[model samples]
Target: MSIIIITGGSRGIGASAAKQCAAKGMGIILTYNSHPAGAESVVRQINAVGGKAVALALDVTKVRSFAAFRDDVAKALKSTWGKDHIDGLVNNAGYGNFNAIEAVSEAEFDGLLNVHLKGPFFLTQALLPLMAAGGHIINMTSATTRVATPGAAPYAAFKGGLEVLTRYMAKEFGPRKIRANAISPGAIRTDMTSKAFDQSPEFVTLLAGQTALGKIGEADDVGRVIASLLSEDNGWVNAQTIEVGGGYNI
Candidate 1:
C-alpha cells in the first residue's frame, strides 16, 4: 500500500484529505499539533470503515522538531505498515491570518512565514531521506496568491513562495523520480477561514457571490483533489499548481 503523511490532519482540509486518501486504500500517518482529539476522531472514522490510519503530533513551525518528527514518522511506518519508506508527503498544515499590508504587524508576518513557507521547506528536507524513490510531494497553497485578497497579504505571500518552492522541488527531485506539485484552493470553508466569518458574517456570502459555482468550497471539495494528486494515476503530472476552486474570481 502507498503510505502517505499528511500534516495538520486533525480537521478541515487535512482531515478530509486523510479520510479520502484512506478510502482509496492508502496507509495514512496524519499529524496534529493542538488537536489530538480531532486527530483520533478522524482515525476512528477511517478505522470504522476498515481503513488504516495513525495520528502523530507535529508543530510545523518548529524547525528543530522536524528531525524528531521524521523519526516518529519512521517509527509509525515501521509499526503501522511494516514499511521503512513513505510514498508521499502532503504539506497541508496551515492557518489563516487576515490583515492588510499596511496594518500587518511583524509578528503576524513572521508567524505566517514560519508555518506556511519555512516549516514546509525544512520539514520536506527532513523527510526526504525517508521518502522512497517515486514518492510524491503535494504542497497546499492558496489561490489568494493570484486573487490579491486585501486582508491576506502575508499569508498569500508565503503561499506563493510555497508554490514556487514546489516547482523547485520537482526540478531538484526529478533525478530521484519524486514529483512535487501545489494545490491552490480558493475560498474554502475551513477552520482557518471560518474564524474570520465568525467576525464578519457576510464574508461567506461575498465569497460565494464571487465564485462561478455560486458557493464557497467545502473541505472535501479540495480533499478529493489532494487524494487524487497523491495517487499513482497522477504520476506524470508534476510541477503544477492546480487551482481547485469552483472558479473563484474568474
Candidate 2:
C-alpha cells in the first residue's frame, strides 16, 4: 500500500484529508500540533472503519525539530507499515490570522511566515530524501492569493510564496519523477474560519455570495480533492495550482 505523510492532520482540511486518503486504501502518517487528542480521535475513526493510520506530534514552526521528526517518521514507517519511505507528503499544516498590512505586527508576520512559508520549505527539504521516486507533494495554498482579502496580508503573502515554491519543486524534482502541486482552497468551513462565521454574519454572507455554489466549502470538499491529487490517476498532473473553491470570486 502507498504511504502518505500529512502535516497538521489533527483537524480541519488536514484531518479530513487523512480520513479520505485512508478510505482509498492508503496508509496515513498524520501530524498534529497542540491537538494530540484530536489526532488520536482521527486515527480512531479511521481504524474503526478498518483503515490504518498513525498520528505524530509536529510543530511546523520549529525547524530545529525536523531532524527528530524525520527520525520519528522513519520509526513509524517501520513499525506501522514496514516501510522506509513515503509515497506522498502534504504540506497542509497551517493557521490563519486576520490583520491588515498596516496593523500587522512583526511577530504576527513572522509567525505567519514561519508556519505558511518557511515551515513548508524546510520541512520539504528535510523529508525530500525519504520521498521515493514518483512521490507527490501537495502544498496547501489559499485562494486569498488570487483575490485580495482584507486583514490577511501576511497569510496570503506566504501562501502565494508557497504556490511559487510548488512550481519550483516540481521543476527541480521532475528528474526524480516526484510531482508537486498547489491546492488553493476558497472559504472552507473549517475551525480556522469559525470565528468569522460565528461572530460576523455579514462577513459570512459576503463569503457565501462570492462563491458560485452559494455556500461555504467544507473540509471534506477540499480533503477529497487533495486525496485525489495524491492518487495514481493524477500522476500526469504536476506544476499546477488548482483552486478548489466552487468557482469562488468569479
Candidate 3:
C-alpha cells in the first residue's frame, strides 16, 4: 500500500484528509500539534475501520525540531509500513487569524509566516529525501489569495506565496516524476472559521450567498480533493492551484 504523511492531521482539513486517504487504502502517518488526544482519536478511528495509521507530534513553526521529527517518521515507516519511502506529503497544518495590514503586528505576521510558509518550506526540504519517486505533494493554501477578504491580508499574502512555491516544486521535482499542487478552499466550515459562523449568522449567510453553490463547504469537500490528487488518477494533473470553494465570488 502507498504510504502518505499529512501535517496538522488532528483536526480541520488535515484530519478530514487523513481519514479520506486512509479510506482509499493508503497507509497514513499523520502529524498533530498541541493535541495528542485528537491525533490518537483519529488513529483509533482509522484502526477501528481496519486502516493503518500513526500520529506524531509536530510544531511546524519550530524548524529546529524537524530533524527529530524526520527521525521519528523514519522509525514509523520502518516499524509500521515496512517501507523506506513515503508516497505523498500534505503540508496542511495552519491556523487562521484576521487582522488588517495596518493593524497587524510584527509578531502576528511572523507567527503566520513561520507556520504557513517557512515551516512548510523547511519541513518539505527535510522530508524530500524520503519521498519516493512519483510521490505527490499537496500544499493546503487558501482562496483568500484570490478573493480580497478584509482583515486577512497577511494570511492571504503568505498563502499566495505558497501557491507560487507549489509550481516551483512541481517544476523542480518533475525529473523524479513527482507532482505538486495547491488546494485552495473558500469559506469552509472548519474549526478555524467556527467562531465567525457561531457569533454572526449574517456573516455566514453573506459568504453562502457569495458562493454559486449557495452554501459554504465542509472539511471533507476539500479533503476528498486532496485524496484524489494523491491518487494515480490525477497523475497528469500537476502544477495547479485547484479552488474547492463551490465557485465563490463568481
Candidate 4:
C-alpha cells in the first residue's frame, strides 16, 4: 500500500487533502499540532468511509523533534500498513500572522521562519531515508509570495523562500527519482481568512475582484489539486509551483 504523511491534517486544506487522498485509496499518516480531537475526527471519518488513516501529533516548528517524529512515522507504517517507507510527504502545517515589516518583532519573524522554511527543510531531510524511490514532496506555500500583500511581509517572504527551496529540493533529489513541487493557495474561506473577510466587506470585494474566477477559493479547491499532483498521473510534473488561486491578481 502507498502511504503518505501530511502535516496539519486536522483542518482546512490539510483535512480536505487527507480525505481526498484517502478516497483515492492511499493510506494516510496525518499530523496535528493542537487539535487532537479534530485529527481523530478526520481519522474516524476516513475509516468510516472505508479508507485507512492515522493521526499523530506534531509541532512543525520544533525541528529538533523531527528524528523522533520520523521514527514514529516508520513505526506507524510498519504496524498499520506493513510497510517501512512512505510515498509522499506534504509539508502543510503552518500558522498565519499579519504584521507589517516595521511592526514585525524578532520573535515573530523567527517563529514564521521556523515553521515555514526551517522545519520543512529538516523534516524532509530526516525522513528522506525512509521515503520510497519516485516519492514526491509537496510544500504548501501561499499566493502572497507572488503578489505582495500589505501587513504580511514576513510571512510572504518566508513562503517565497519555501518556493525557491522547492526547486532546489527537486534538483538535489532528482537522482533518487523524488520530485518536489509547491502549491500556492489564494484566499480560501478557512479559519485563517474568516476574520479578514468578516471584518471588511470591502476587503472581500477587493480580493474577489483580483481573482479572475470571480470568487474566493474553498479549501477543497486547493486540496484536490494537491492530491492530484501526488498521483501517478502527474508523475512527470516536477519542480513546479502551481498556483491554486482563482487567478488572483492576474
Candidate 5:
C-alpha cells in the first residue's frame, strides 16, 4: 500500500487530509504535537472505514527531534503497512500568532520561523531517505503571505519563505521523481481560526465579502486538494502554489 505522513494531522487541514487520503487507499502515518486525542480520533475514523492509519507525536519547532521522528516513521511504516518507504509527506504542522511587527518579540519571530519554514526544510531533509521514488512533498502556506494582513507579519513572512522553498524542493527533488507544491489557503474555518470567527462575526463577514466565493473555506475545502495532489492523477502538477482561498483579495 502507498504510505503518507501528515504532520499536525490531529486537527484541521491535516486531520481532514489524513481521512481523505486513507479513503483513497493510502496508508497514513499522521503526527501531532499536543493533541493526542484529536490524532487518535482521526486514526479511529480512518480505521472505522477500513482504512489504515497511525498517529505519532511531533513538535515542529524542535528540529533536533526530526531524526528520531524519522525513525519512528520508519517503524510505523514497517509495522502498520509493511512498507519501507513513504510515497508522500504533507508538512501541515503550524500555529498562528497574530502580532504587529513593531510589537513582535524576537522569541515570537523565531518560534514562527522555526515551525513554518526552518522545520519543514530540515524535516523533509531528515525524511528524504525514506521517501520512495515519485514521492510528493506538500508545504502548507497561507494567503496572508499575499494579502499583507496587519497583525500577522512574522507568520506571513515565514509562510512566504516556505512557498519559495517548495519550488526549490521541486527543482532539487525532481530528478528523484518527487514533486513539491504549496497550498495557500485563505480565511479558513478550522479550530485554529474558529475562535476568531466566533469572537467577531464582523470579521468573518468582512473576509467573506473580500472572497470571490463569498465564504471562507472549511477544512475539507483544502483537505481534498491535498489528497488530490498526492494522487497519481496530478503527477504533472509540480512546483506551483495553488491558492485554495476562494479568491480572497482578488
Candidate 6:
C-alpha cells in the first residue's frame, strides 16, 4: 500500500485529508503539533473503518527538529507499514493570523514566515531522502494568495512564496520522478475559521457573496481533492496550484 505523511493532521483540513487519503487505501502517518488527542482521534476513526493510520507529534515551525521528525517518520513507516519510504507528503500545518500590514508586528510576520515558508522548505528537504520514486508532494496554500485579502498580508505572502517553491520542487525533484503541486483553498469552514463565522455572521455572508457558488467551502471539498491528487488519478498533474475555491473573486 502507498504510505503518505500529512502534517497538521490533528484538525481542520489536515484531519479531513488524512481520513480521505486513508479511504483511498493509503497508509497514513499524520503529524500534530499541540493536539495529539485530535490526531489520535483521526487515527482511531481511520482504524475503525479498517484503514491504517498513525499519529506523530511535529511542530513544523521548528526547522531544527525536522531531522528528528524525519527519523520518527522513518520509524513509523517501518513499524506501521513495514516500508522504508513514503509515497507522498502533505505540507498542511499552519495557523491563521489577521492583521493589516501597517499594524503587523515583526514577531507576527516572522512567525508566519517560519511556519508557512521556512518550515515547508526545510521539512521537505529533510524528508526528501525518504520519499520514494514517483512520489508526490502537496503543499496546502490559500486563495488569499490570489485575492489579496486585506488582513492576511504576511500569511498570503508566505503562501505565495510556497506556491513558487512548489514549482521549484517539481523542477528539482523531476530527476527522482517526484511531483509537486499546491492546493489553494478559499474560506473553508474549519476550527481555524469557526470563531469568525460564529462571532461575525456578516463576515461569513460577505465571503459567501464573494464566491460564485454563493457559499464558502467545507474541509471535505479540499480534502477529497488532495486525496485524488495523491492518487494515480492525477499522475500527470504537477507544478500546479489548484484553487479549490468555488470561483471566488473571479
Q: Is candidate 1 or candidate 2 better by lDDT?
A: 2
Candidate 2 has an lDDT of 0.95
Per-model clash counts, in order, read 0, 0, 0, 0, 0, 0
Worst lDDT run of 10 residues, candidate 1, spans 192-201
Candidate 2 ranges beyond 4 A from true positions:
none
Error of 4 at 222 (Å): 0.6
Candidate 5 lDDT, 94-189, residue by residue in tens: 999999889999999999999999999999999999999899999999999889899999999999999999999999999999999999999999
- Which is superior by TM-score, 1 or 3? 3
63-141: candidate 3 lDDT, tens digit per residue: 9999999999999999998999999999999998789889999999999999999999999999998999999999999
Model 5, residue pairs in steric clash: none
lDDT of 4 by residue, 162-194 (tens): 999999999999999999999999988886778
lDDT score, candidate 1: 0.94
Superposed model 3: Cα runs more than 4 Å off: none
| Two-way lDDT contest, 1 vs 4, winner | 1
| Native-to-model Cα distance after best TM-score fit, residue 92 in candidate 5, in Å | 0.4
- Local distance difference test, per candidate? 0.94, 0.95, 0.94, 0.93, 0.95, 0.95
Over the stretch 1-250, how does candidate 2's per-residue lDDT look in tens digits?
A: 9999999999999999999999999999999999999999999999999999999999999999999999999999999889999999999999988887899999999999999999999999999889999999999999999999899889999999999999999999999999999999998889788877889888878889999999889999999999999999898999999999998999
What TM-score do all the candidates reach, one by one?
A: 0.97, 0.99, 0.99, 0.98, 0.99, 0.99
Clashing pairs in 2: none
Q: Model 4, poorest ten-residue lDDT window? A: 187-196
